[model samples]
Target: MTGLSGSGKSTAGRLLAQRLGRPLFDIDVLIEQHYGERIPTIFAHHGEEYFRDLESRILERTIQQTDSAIIVTGGGIVIRSENRQLMATHGVRIYMQVDPQISLERLRAQIASEEQQGKRPELRPMLAGPDPLANLLTMQATRESWYQEAEYLCVTNGRPVEHVVQEIIDMIEPTRNENEHAASLIGTPELSEPSTSDPVIPPIIRHVHIGDGYDTIVEWGGLSHIAEHLQRLSLPPRVFLITDSNIHDFYAPMLVARLRAAQFEPHVYTIPAGEASKSQRQLNAIYDWLVDQHAERREALIALGGGVVGDLVGFAAATYLRGVPLIQIPTSLLAQVDSAIGGKTGINHAKGKNLIGAFYHPRLVLADPLVLLSLQTRSRTEGWAEIVKYGIILDAELFALLEAHAEALREFSPASKALFCQIIARCIDLKVTIIEEDEREQGRRAILNYGHTAGHALENASGYGEWLHGEAVSLGMVVAARLAQKAGLYASEDVERQNNLLTALGLPTTYHGTVSAQDILSRMQLDKKVVGKRVHWIMPERIGQVRSMTLPDELVTQVVTEFFGAEEDHSHA
Candidate 1:
């Protein structure tokens, strides 16, 4: 078991070992036992590097020697790549996840209780700082990528030790059984049979199973096979279809017919097509429609349109009788790539975009790239902005892919279907990984909003529909790139590459419309990401790398003004 200090790794391991009738081996204890010295004393005399080397050797030796044992390791063990490889290959590695704040409190409580016994304090060399909580958070962020490499991640905060242990066991046992079953079938005739389909072919269906949430399936022709996929899920017979007028006119009949063929009842409700539909008045209308249709908790809500429809319908699902099951059928490229996957659902407030919202994960997300063929050029190109954001933040390989296929993507050509499917799947995977790590916008997830801070401000400053959400974000990303360069946080060439990519995709790189810089800044102040009146600007350090920093108000204003045009008034209105 591995996790942050005071994350109950040792306790859980001991309990799990006892329950399993296995020996419990604590690596730290073994080191101290071997040297006849305390951990802190070892660290103080020999330094961290020496301790780490000794820890690695002992951990490898213990794993090699014991065929079946519960090995509780130090949190820092993951820092070494060799240790991680050994753990991954040799045994099931379980990560005990805990909130940094909770870990800090637990450590403090342990320290205080230990002091009462008149014993020497358990000195955590890493926790030696004026702000231990901050230190813990920093350390957690640094090691999170490595911790996620574990086979299973168990959230241990406020959970009973027995419960956490049981969860770990439950997660591991199924995998062990599956492995055994697969081993038993290895020599079976089924494996030797020649298949009609190509064995080397990549799967068209990209299935992302979010833990206890829902599965997200992205395929090229998924919309037509919606009923087939729905049959596999545990959805109710009745589906409340929430779509926009434009999407209804184009795709609703086929979907309704398919559902009917499957003997599932589908009730359709089409709001006017646009951002204007995602308002309180429209939301009330949806509630009225649901009530009129006698929608029940057991019934499912299907959001079938772009981000606007998905957000509106998702919010309705979340609120109407305290949420019903939601299935996202994202038609537009923007929805398929970004909004439809994450559980962020809400209507725009008069004050700002997504001002009213809820963290409601959907029952399923079905993204069909075939729908993009029907999208107008503007809508399709605008969606590319969000796709680019994913590249800028998390995946350099995706960024390169976009660059390589820039022309084909711009035309939305028939040949690009396979490439687009891969793009959508990659983007969805990146988002799912981040969402799994930080389900709420606690820390790491904020990177997903790389361009939204300025983008949302622009959308609010201008009328909501004046600039499409993706177009605004495209502009926002450019502004962020410029700000990063100005602040010397990002390289000039990287910014240029971003601009070139956006320009090549026919996405807006600058706000051409007339909007006051101060007004935009004022709207940005209302952003949810703002902490203590400071906006957390997500700056691109390089492709696939971004960092969030709270910039001074003046610096933000200057960046906004420079990007929107210097003639715009910066003074408060």
Candidate 2:
């Protein structure tokens, strides 16, 4: 079982073990007992890398040693691919998918109770922040993509623990036997489906202008439909197409071709793939390219690619000629669902991921779901991670859809295509609504960062390239669940549900690498989300809902240590 620190994974796991008459092992407590010291001390003394290695080694041994015990995992255990593989090979993995709102409430209640019991800690990230809510929002946005990929996906919406547990039992019971053969059940194939040339545009639900009943699905009818959306924008100056090589090949020509067809002179600039491309060097290169192309402030820059391309291009657009009009044409799932809609764009810095950027909203966003059809399977799967985020933050119905039809939606089939379009459209609407209400991430927007507090730090510490944005998010979501559990907002069943969903979607639910608690917490401290040196975690109160909460630095550190205790040995500093 896995979830945020205060999310109650331990309680649920123990209950499940008791019900099944099996032994239960809480990975965090086990690690602490094995080390004969607190996890926070280990992090303070040895660092995250060392802790991560030890966690992986110990986890390997534990799984090998155990028979049919109900195992409770540290939140960070799913960060590494190896740990996920181990879970796949050994026992069933369950995640507690709770809401940030509930997590905050639960933690508050637990802390109050604990205080009554005279328990105390030295560091607390939440206690240090001035605007704890704002800091919490930042964490949610950063890690939003990770928590959405859990396998079982149960929403802990402040319900009784027994009810949540019953739901999980119904989903995972051996008698039902659905999950046992889940691997063999394929949804749709990559190439067997229709290509972009075979356009399937849906009616314009939001912008219904140029074409009478024009069809536009962000991924499939992407650039081809941009001209119509631009018409709504009153034909902003010359357009600059900024993208990476991967995206340039698939849709740049089509976008530029259509732009020229519409009597606009368009220029295309390409960058390499990976987070490394989002740097000062790349930014300077883009500056030179924009200058060479005579890009003016009037001409809008269209960001086309996954999150990396979107962030880099969006930042360039933000800085170039004092902020040019930006039009977002997000091609990736992550982009379409999260980054593309919010206007939060920026590049990575050596100090951290997305360390530098701007919150420049696009004049308009064009999401073509068909584009996902051509996306690599891993990339497409990564996108699903964000789709799951929509469910975690504000749409329980969407969560049910994902749980019910993940297989069907895996490949971009016609059914899957429509589902993707519907899902993206809904997410876009939700995001736009949040942005409109809290463009600066003041209140409701903070809920969007449901699982990102630790997600970003994990990305930064792992060296972004080591894990795909979605992969990091996948593991990060579990960490958030564990943290939530620690905060006491949920039960173990919620964590289990999240884990089942993630495993079903082929996402990680544990961290098994060599990153220690202190390093992760330090990197988190460096995050833009932290205010007044405080760490705010955006946890869920239920599926489709979230809440921002301020935690004490000591509690945050302890939670981090508990999550990373599994990796205490053989890890680097």
Candidate 3:
């Protein structure tokens, strides 16, 4: 058991062990018994480093000695990565959670009561500060990520010790039985079969091994494998699933059932289904829900819808508790190809799209193509716009592939699963390579925003919900092609090919909205991509080649004016 001091880790572990008929090994008690001194005394005599090293050694010995024992560790045990790995590897790690304020209050009350009884308990070294509650909060913030590494999280605040123990037992019993059953089947014929179905082969998972942090996985029908993936990653069993109403209506029940089967406790939070949901109000509501659920850092915030849900929930996961584990289960084609793969999380400000956000990566991205089968035609076509952007900005082969199967893709027939998966994987591969080179979008990754400058501007000017992100991007790509043509940087035939392809895919090749060119220019100026008061335009030079240029305001205005068929205004110039 792991948690802040006075959060009942020791008490719960003891009771749980008693109920399970297993030996209970409390690390703190063992350490105190072995040293013949209190923890505070040890900390005072030997530095914290010394105590931690001794604690690690004792913990290792304890684990090696008893294979079936409930081990209660020091709250700071997870602070050491090796200690976390050991606990995760050896047993079912459970986190006893409580609000910092409540835990601190409990500790203070315990100390006062003990003193009144004429038996003063040893004061915790961490709680020695003038403001113990503040110290606890600070410590919790620092170690929250580590504590979140536990597989199970149980809230102990305002709950009886027995209730908390029962929660832990309920979480662990199924896993225990499964483990025993596996042990019994070690040499049986059933054990010889593969763990997953044949269609869900492991090799189908496209792993993005980028950097020291988490990698990404893109696979067909990957949603069914979410439980196994979570177990393998050792993510906490609790999930805060964030989805839009539409996606929740379709996918929530199935996903919840699957998660339950995997012994996961999932809580669903549904927002309205549209870009309108990606706002400050919805974000605050999500934060409130997280707090109400007593969400811990180790638990996951699973974004289970399109880009709107992904962006909203991803930003919430990034900021709430200073960040928690994120799992992106992108259902829309647009998200599977682009938005979900990148770590860009945000909400639209009044002036611009994705103005308030962070670059927090998800622990996992599960893009199941099967979900796209039920997608509306408009959503599917909107997604093609991004998929086409991938082809134009990075891979000519992908461009040609889409061109060859443009009609079939539009139909989105059941027989087109392989083609859809191929397209999704290729797009993800291109994105992963770019993200690996520039994780924070400081340089090379900007190419991925091929048409986003004008695209975002259009979305903002049209009041976000007027056009799907893909639709705006589709028109934005057309504007970009025209700009490239006017600059004489790209061949006219290539621009024509782009137009033809988009038209064939039933994507927008023009925008007839009321937003004036000036309004769009103003919105573009507020874009995150603007550098030195100039918008960075991604111009396609050819099928697979693109370049970024800081075009003059007048030139961009003229191009956008032509697209909107509006009179160009030169007041700013």
Candidate 4:
């Protein structure tokens, strides 16, 4: 249930849940309970981003915990695409649309009644403003589309709670029967999908549009719709798909089945899953496979796994026949948010990660958050390390969202796919902006290396694949933030906030690699981004902003020593 702040959604949802014999999850109350503070206090202290983050986290949790419940969301809940998508998928979304005057009147009457009973009413943030009705009108206009997307709309302007509850109950009963019948038919695939030759994928379905015919498509059941996305790109129907052995059995077959149905020929090559497979050896093998198939330059190369597969396949697409169309279907969170978006494709050297490659953009990038549900908890949580970097470097609101939803994002499952989708879309958008400004990392793009400088060094010093990239990055961010504070370019409290946020998300904020700090510092020199014999350091000035500059060798060496010397064994992270 959602609508204006005083639209009686809370009262209606509670009574409706009781009548229906289901649990009621109120997002506003949950926030108050979790933080030990009321809505207005939370908003005033943490700002709107923090409050919205909390709102999103609470909404996601409630959606996950209950299969059958009436959820009462705050007025501003519809402002977030993730929350709206989740609600649409999980429950019968109902918008309580009523006059602002009537809603305010009802709120005031309720408050007076509570005071007469010697009880204090919970103050709403929306109502705390000087001109609440104007705020309500503005919010309603902003979220009009979101409200209209709901399955049902309820108006309780002159009605009682019982009447509203009854109307909602009548609406839900028929849908329950239809949904149960549909669930039994879930795994049954359509023998044939209507083929479209329009060669134009709608912008709505395509999540991130990077202009010039390049788009990133992200959706839950998007694998089944690959033909539709590909049709618009107008590439040769005969495509080569490269994926890791671990993922071939799961997604490759499904994708192949769909492609073949659409009259396309798809030849899949499965490589071993790990950092080792992203090498010249695998590249040679792929070249051999493509040669045997007589693959042409216009045909597309589809990458269908994590970073390892993406890097290897992307390089093959870049160098093979001088350049072929490329499509990325990144299944892992790390790849979907970081590796897959940037056109930087490469293989690791004996000494470093991504030491060899090219700046080749994929014609299309398709990411399914549903696929992430198949990943282990550790694999899923590690992706947030790179995601946190986006928030710190370019977007403070994104950072706060991460801070608020750290736990849910860490333990993501089916219930959290929509939020993850939104998160992935956000990361992709940020990377796209940077890529457009400096596709070759000439200037602003270098800020993306915020945590990656020390992060890559850790990976190199610890031995490739010894420490996951995200773990190294988690510690790298902490070290970078500390360096910023020490240089007097950042606040100590800001450093603590970054550290705390990383820690809360189950990311390691301290180094525990066995390699000596001095060795790690030396490896930092070998970074592919080095120029003028100086390493570019991306340091934070606050939660959302950062500047790129090379720090003093002594300061860098001392910080490295401090981290590498720590006794804490969060390396297990």
When sorted by lDDT, best at the front, the candidate numbers are 1, 3, 4, 2
Estimate the lDDT of model 1.
0.80
TM of each candidate vs. truth: 0.64, 0.62, 0.64, 0.64
Q: Model 3: per-residue lDDT, tens digit, 127-160?
A: 8878888888888999998888877888876454
In candidate 3, which residue pairs clash? Answer: 148-298
Query: Mind giving the per-residue lDDT tens digits that candidate 4 earns over 101-139?
Result: 666655654454445334677666667789877777777
Instruction: Provide C-alpha RMSD values for all models, in order.
Output: 27.8, 22.6, 20.0, 21.2
Clashing pairs in 1: none
Taking the tens digit of each residue's C-alpha lDDT, what string does model 2 give over 373-444? 556567778776777777877888888888998777764454355666777888877776776678777778
Q: What is the C-alpha lDDT of each candidate?
A: 0.80, 0.67, 0.79, 0.77
RMSD of 4: 21.2
Q: Write the per-residue lDDT of candidate 1 for residues 332-417, one digit (tens) a residue.
A: 99999899988999998889889998989888898878677656678888899999999999999999999998987897754456
Q: What TM-score does structure 3 among the candidates reach?
A: 0.64
- The clash number for model 4 is 0
Whole-structure CA lDDT of model 3: 0.79
